[model samples]
Target: MVVLKMKTISLKVNGITKEITVEDNELLLNVLREKLGITSVKAACWRGECGLCTVLLDGIPVKSCMTLAVETDGKEVITAEGLYSDERAKKLMESFVKHGAMQCGFCTPAFVVTSHYVLTKNPEVDGEELKKELNGVICRCGTYYQIYEAVKDAEKYYKKETKS
Candidate 1:
């Protein structure tokens, strides 16, 4: 008889503390979407080439599919759902919609997450610098210009929001 070993991981997901038991080999993407029902973290391009599984791990953008579930133990994670609660993120979403940055909607969440990370880290980044910063996220719909514009506008709005 073979006994499978399981690890219990407790991590904060979208401002909520969640404890889940997972196999040693299980990926964070699976646990998030399957166990916790956080579908915003997509498993597209399991090899991490697509950047569709991007999420904020300890306030830093990371690919969920490539991270092991056990590695997230006692860590902080924020998905698109969590971002929605932030004022700056809401403004960013509005900017994306206004600029038509999303088409198929499959990659919007990842882009939004990345944009929030970039803008929060460097509020003044613009032009080619902004593009290079967000190069990790890939939108198959060819909405780069729209995404850039939205991010640019969002940076301004976010700055304004923080001022008040």
Candidate 2:
């Protein structure tokens, strides 16, 4: 008889270092929410389409549901919780709130994570480019228009902040 043991790995999630033992088949999203107790990364469409499980893997947006737990070993994973205090994130949240970009709140985390990637990568992005970048994320609450507007406004906010 052969026995398989779960692998223990270390990862820095949301700026915190954690060591966890996970099964080979475990997804990063599950580990994050269940094991690490970080519920900000919501699990919606388990399939990579919802974008609700989005997270920052070394500053690039990735679908946590499709990512393997072991693959995050020794890497940095930033969740929506980590962005709560970030200036850019603050601006995004403010814009979203003021522009009515968030409705049900299920998809906001993904949009925030994805927007972080977009705005940080290019603060000068126009509405068309912002919409194109956010194409992969599906918001079931029908807040696409307001979401796009929020991203555009966030870009302008960040640009002004950086210049001064």
Candidate 3:
């Protein structure tokens, strides 16, 4: 008989620390969406090509679909929902809404999380760099321009925060 080893892992999702048991070979995407009930980490292309399952692992964006649950042990993951309390993220969200960047809304969460990371890392990122940084997540509705504008609009908030 084949046996799957179950292991306990402690991971923080959306600012909440959770210690849960999972199979040794379980994927982080599954653990986050299924076990932890974090639906923002979409499951479009399970192969990680879509980047919809992206999450900030230890403050760096990574495809949860491509990561193993065991690897996330003792790691901190931040999703779009986790950034809700941040002033910059709030501005970003507002900008997205104002610019109508969330058509269809399927990829919004991932884009938000990545965009938040980019703004946090480099609030002064230019258009080309922002485009490159956001290339990982695809918006099927072709709302790229709006998304770009939204991110740019929110840049000032991050810059202000940085100066403070």
Q: List the residue pairs that clash in candidate 3.
A: none
In angstroms, the error of model 2 at 44 is 1.7
Regions of model 1 farther than 4 Å from truth: 1-3, 161-164
Question: On residues 1-164, what C-alpha lDDT tens digit does candidate 3 reach at each position?
Answer: 77878899998888888998999889999988888888988999888788999999999999999999999999999998899988889889999999999768999999999999999999999899999999999899999999999999999999999999
In model 1, which residue pairs have backbone atoms overlapping below 3 Å? Answer: none
By descending lDDT, how would the candidates be arranged?
3, 1, 2
Q: With candidate 3 superimposed using the best TM-score fit, by how many Å does residue 66's alpha carbon deviate from the native?
A: 0.4
Give stretches of model 3 more than 4 Å off. Answer: 1-3
1-164 per-residue lDDT for model 1 (tens digits): 66779988899999999888999889999988999888988878899888999999999999998999999999999999999889889999999999999889899999999989988887888688888878888899999999999999888877776577
The local lDDT score (0 to 100) that residue 67 gets in candidate 1 is: 96
What is the overall TM-score of model 3 with all chains considered together? 0.96
Give the higher-lDDT candidate: 1 or 2: 1
lDDT of 2 by residue, 56-130 (tens): 999999999999999988999998889887887888888988899987988888898899889988899877888
User: What TM-score, to 2 decimals, does candidate 2 have?
Assistant: 0.93
Best by TM-score: 3
Residue 118 CA displacement from its true place in model 1, Å: 0.4
